[model samples]
Target: MMSRPLATALRDATLLGAALLDVFVHVTSDEPLRMAVALAAASLLLLRRRLPLLTFLLTLPSVLLSDAIFASLAALYTLATITRRRTLLAVCAMAYTLSDMTRWTPSPHLDLWNPSALITLGYTAATAAAPVFLGQLVQARRDLSLRLTEISQARDHERRLSAQAVLAEERAQLAREMHDVVSHQVSLIAVRAGALQVATQDAEAKQAAATIRRLSVQTLNELRHMVNVLRGSHNRPTELTPQPSLTDLRRLIDTSGIDTELTTDLPGDLPPTLQRAVYRTIQEALTNVRKHAPGATADVRACFEGDTVRVTISNTAPTRPALPLPSAHYGLIALHQRAALLGGTVTCGPTPDGGYRLRLELPVKQEP
Candidate 1:
């Protein structure tokens, strides 16, 4: 039945309603035709729910003229469910007004004050209002879904950014550690080579010279490793060698010059990242002292207080600045940044006792 054109069923019922009311009103009293008209009206009524406005117009003439006013009620229901609320309301109101005005012509007078009339008016208003309400409900749900999706996407992006930041920091810390490990060893080699240069009085010194050369080569290899650590260019994860911790500062002291006084309460076996930072801080401070305080005695102190590893380097200040400062001592600036990244700090200045004082402190770990 759905395959048939909707318009056909509506026309049949309208014609039938008109014929039934006409005969009843003494307009056409053919008994056989009246029965057929009533059947056609039933057909249009059934299909009216599928196409409200069309069925209403088709059945309107007969309903308005005779006892068939009841036909419009079903059509109004369909309009409320399927069409826009404004259109449904306007159509229903107009149908009511036209049907009522026909009372001036020989039609049945509709008493607006009657309960039946009020019921019909209420039904029409509900039909129009329902569509607007449902549309609003559906729209609200869609907006909520969109907001949830946006929040989810933002959270995922935030996680990714945090992971990248952590990875970058780890790479930098590894670099600083490798540089300290390699630099300390290199300074020792240079010092030993100077001593060997003075003690040799025979050809046997040639062996000592060779040993020094070997040490220099070992130091060069460490420098290369330090560079690779900073660049972090390895594709394989295992290619990145692990570094020593702050516990290894004893190695640093062993190679260091006279007047070295080590005092550290720093955490033992600290997080690799924080330990690497502390190692670099000491390396830079000592390097600066050796270069700037030539012929002047100094003392080195490293202390661990709670969450921080503090390194202080103090040396008698010279009347003149060091002859060579190696490009404004970029090492000190690098050390400052390393400590800051770890949530620590660094300070370098002239001591009240006329000595250079350097101190650095950095955090133990990233915040959870």
Candidate 2:
């Protein structure tokens, strides 16, 4: 590719050569003064872009003295392309027209209204207007190209912002799930191990329980740190875990140690978002049961009802008072957020039988 300065220099050389050829064809070398003025006008074309107005003024004398007006036309066009001053361009065009219309050695007693003279004046005006209009057209085209480039850059910037916002939202969601689900289960393990360490009589069994409790506590600490990092207010990049779906419900219940009964009749081809919402709803409900209702049994029922799939988790009253523990209490809020995103609803309240119930309902086909 040719560099800009090199290309510009080459173009100036070409225009100067064309102007010199015009001078050679019209202005005779036998006339020393006319030839010198024409050559000087052509040489001034090299400086047209840098000093357009001065170059045009200098070339006008050559147009009046001889027929070599190529340099003057080129200078006028260069001026028109670079400046937005319309009045100045019109004045320059008129100057060129008047200069081209008159001869240096005027005949005494020349008619002011000759038909041939009027025709010559009209032709000179039209020729001068040609370069002005063409230069304006080139100027408008360059402006339009620059405007289009700016618009394209703005759209690309907006797209990047939208993508970052989506990624940040997903990271916050993952952080919520880890806090509600993983933290809840680890706390349970720590609680159980603490009880076993106190209740067991064998030295080896007590030591094992103590080890488990200590490790569980450490794991919970690391998990809390990870959650904080994931929910970074600044929205930095982070790793994501696999999402839970309805198929994992059975294993979740078994490992939860909450004495829960699971009954699900969901379609196998359910959308991933719908499946995830169902699974998280049940998990959060069970976690709540384990936290607030000790030694209580839960019943999890999920099935299709018309166009909606309904999941209900009901737990009996606690057999013993629940031990106080540290909690952020964001489980139900996160569940509600997840349901809202899927165009669903989550409702929970105390039951008439002194127990708690959480219900989730979602449509099989979501709306846009």
Candidate 3:
């Protein structure tokens, strides 16, 4: 593509060449004074962009002295396109018309009432007005193009806002469904478990009912958090419930139902993220035993080895026939991802004795 400066330079050179040609055709070399003025007018065309009014005034001498008027016309057009003062443009047009019509002689006379003189005056005025009108037309075109670009940008912005509005509405609907249907069902389950715990006479049955009530309440709390998140409550800070950590491990094992043992030498002051990762890994391991290895016993071990924390969970093979259950099967994958985030590693596989063993190792001090 041609660069703007190069294009503009080429255009100015072309206009100057045309002005030179006009001077060559009308102003003869024998009339040295008139020829000099015409040449000066043509050369002054170079300053039209920056000094249009001055260039036009200098070129007027050529229009009055000789028939070379191209430089004057180009200057007037440049001034008209750049300036919005219509009165100034009209005055300049009138000046050019008078200069073009009057002869170079000091005592030049015009018979104002003569039909030919009036017609000549009108023709000169129309010629001067042509450049002004063309320049204004070009200016209007530029303004219109700019206005159209602004309008297009505004429409695109409106479309984006409308799309966001639709997405927000969908999220609100999902939140309402979870609160109205899912929460209500979980609330009923918790109430029934509480009632069962109170009414049951068998100690084992009462303990089971208590565990069920506790788990249902926890699930409800989690559901409420999810609904709030979905509802897009950004006006105020939302306080999420406390996340699980090493401190909650004992309660989790007690409520897990499967026979499990937990042994840990992890410090109480460990970073909350590390504690949560360890807690979740043990929890998932025990849950898998209860679901896929019914009647299996699980052993969870966690200890600080120098600058690293090592954790392992092992479960014996199922004593009874494993029941088919719905699973997303992402538990092991999730554990590995969690460990990786903490600059750690997780490994799990079946043992020779028909058992499963999962191990996680994490650095005690996290890298920034």
Candidate 4:
């Protein structure tokens, strides 16, 4: 492709060459002064783009003094392409009217009122209009193309924003579902477990009931945490509430409504975020058991091994038929994401004994 400067130089050269050729072809006299003036006028066409009005003014003398028609036409075309339409029209009208008065000749004895003189004037007007019309047409096409490009870019931007808005709305809907359905059901499970634990006499039955209630309370805390996060700047009352920590795990396990045990040897001082992740991991594991293995016995263990905290919750197969409950399939996935964000990992799957096991491993400290 031609560089801009090279292309412009080539265009100016072509216009200058055309003007000189026209002057040479139309020269009615071989006078040296007329030839020199015509050549000067043609040379001025090279500067037309940079100084179009000045070039046109310089070429006007050649048009009036000699028959350098093409030189004047080139200058007028350059001006028409660069200047406004009204300006070009006014200049063209004035220049040609002067030319007709000074240089146009119909016949030796004919006056301005003669039909031949009117024809000559009309021909000169047409000659001036031709290049101006072409310049305006080219400018109009360029403007239209630029406007189309702007409109296309604006449409693409609108589409991107619309997609973002849709994603935000979907996230808000998911938050609503978690709050309305999951939190409400988990709270009921906790309440039922608490009542059963208080009313039971068997050591194993009481232990299981306590575990259910404990886990339910933990789930409620975590749910509140997530709700606050989703609410953003809504300025709700829950925004300032404290989040759950590892210290709450014992209380959490004591509320589960199934036979469950918790053994933990965690540090007293852990990062608040990591504590929350650990609590949520255990809460979600118990919630899964409550949903899928209603009468199953479960074991939960947490310990600091080297530089990491590991928690494992395992439940035996359900002792009764599982309840039919609607599931969004998001609980464990959400738990996995929370662990990952804290630079931890979670694994949950069926065990060889036809049971479920959820394991979480997190760093002892918050990742930088």
Candidate 5:
């Protein structure tokens, strides 16, 4: 079935054709004029959309040669439809409206004072003025709605652009953190271990060298994870990967290059964020312990109180003076910020009992 708009246009075209054909049959006194009227009337529908203003202007010639009521009205509506130039339409409507109005005349039958004449006059004025005013109102509303829709689409596009820009900025920032924290620390561990492998003739030094190499690999693995997280695109769960958790504290203790012991009162299931935090805190403290307090015994204790988790790492006094990692240690700071982002606090200091100590406290988010 034809849609409503197409069906309506077809009906109007047929009616316009009939009305113009009737007037054409009455008006032409000769074959030549008759042929022209038939061509113009039939062509009006086809030309109305293609040449709206031209169609309206062409109908003026018909007003003198023809008296087709519906054809003239259709031309008026066409003028209103594709009207880019409103001034011409306004002028034509005004001229016709005024012409249709009555003026007082000498003959009583033809005078504007006649009630029948007045009604016909009013009808003409209304015909001309009503279509013009209604057309203008409809056109104004259409133009306004079109402008509003365009503005709304532009705002939506801007929001998408803004979101993309912010994501790019975040990825760049995270990349910098990974390079600064994870890369530098891992590189130092590799270099130090390599140096120790060549220099130390003692079995103790050889063992520490092996531990450093293991820690360096662990650092590189964690760094890869950090990079993946920054990308924020993956089908697999991040938790599936080896995450340095409080459970991993024992592993870190083994790398401390000292006698190590651990006691845990941690929950069986830990939130990934808090677990990761506890892991890094232990890792950083042990890295420091390996660098400063070589051969010193260390104790690791982790306990959860209510919905909060904490880790305490304390090592015997430095055999040599305690030093920060040879290169920049970005992991500690990144860990600090990570803990803070997850509503937690991190503290590192020297123990009163001649030992280096670090502590981390993180709030747990329980599944409801």
Candidate 6:
């Protein structure tokens, strides 16, 4: 690609050569002086981009003296393209008008009605208007193209940010799921192994059970470390805190500012994984209530109906104004994904009494 200065120099040199040829061909008298003046005016075109006003002013005398048309028009065009300032444009117009008026020789019988005089005036007006008008159009186009490029760049940046945000959210959800599912199962394994280690009579069987219990505990610790690494700095304090089972529900309610009532008909020895899921579901629902409907009373109920367990948490509208909080609105989505993974489903929506309700139902027995 050619550099801009070199390209401009070549263009100006071509226009100058053409203007010199036109002057030499058309005007016959004072060949030496006219050629010198025309050459000087054309040379000024080389500086038009850097010093347009000065070049335009300097070329006016040459245009008037030898009618260096191309050089004069190029200077005017450069001036208009570089600046939209009315004062500068007006100065350029005045200089050109003065040059045209002074250069024209009035006929011996000159009058307002003289055909030659009228023609010269019209030609002068065209010379002044045409180049400047063309230059203004070019300037407008350049400005519009620059604005379009900036707007396109801004939109691309926004798209990249949105994609990063989505990826981060997905990673967080994966971390949460790993913590909920793997941790619960490992804890249950450790508990069962511990019970077996105590109950068994044979020394070999007891040692095997003890090994299983120790490995299960080690696996749970490794799983937590992996989750912490994946979560990075965006993980909440709750994520790092110890997992709470259904038995901790009362303690959770006591810490919450809102009035909450919990009623459970769940069996005491339910699978630990199912208990963890129920606890997480209720926890998420209560968090939503605290965030979206602050000061609202909530009711949490867990019941066993045959082979299924249903956990429902519902909250009334806030008695006080809701607090302002930034929410990603993906909590329910993560909950639904968790339920689906456990061969269950979660339903959430506004209650009939102008409140919110979230219900999670899981099978009594879920494959490990």
Give the candidate number with the greatest lDDT: 3
The residue pairs that clash in candidate 6, if any, are: none
In model 4, which regions exceed 4 Å deviation? 1-9, 23-36, 85-88, 104-111, 153-172, 190-368
Candidate 5, residues 254-317, lDDT tens digits: the string is 6556677888889758876778777777777777677778767788889998888888888987
Taking the tens digit of each residue's C-alpha lDDT, what string does model 1 give over 74-128? Answer: 4554555465566655656566556534433544555669897777767655643
What pairs collide in candidate 5?
none
Q: How high is the lDDT of residue 307 in model 2? A: 82
Model 3: lDDT of residue 139:
90
Worst 10 residues of 1 by lDDT: 33-42
Scored by lDDT, model 2 comes in at 0.90
Sorted on lDDT, best first, the list reads 3, 2, 6, 4, 5, 1
What digit string (tens of lDDT, one per residue) describes model 6 on residues 258-366? 6899999998788877888898888889888988897789999999998899998999988777778989988889899989988999998998888999999999774
Off by over 4 Å in 1: 1-199, 202-215, 224-238, 318-321, 363-368
Clashing pairs in 2: none
Q: What's each prediction's TM-score? A: 0.42, 0.60, 0.60, 0.54, 0.47, 0.54
Cα lDDT of candidate 5 equals 0.70
Relative to the true structure, how large is the alpha-carbon lDDT of every model?
0.64, 0.90, 0.91, 0.81, 0.70, 0.82
RMSDs, each prediction? 16.5, 13.7, 6.7, 7.9, 14.0, 17.8
Question: Where's the lowest-lDDT run of ten residues in candidate 4?
Answer: 232-241
Misplaced by over 4 Å in model 6 are 1-9, 26-31, 104-119, 194-215, 229-368
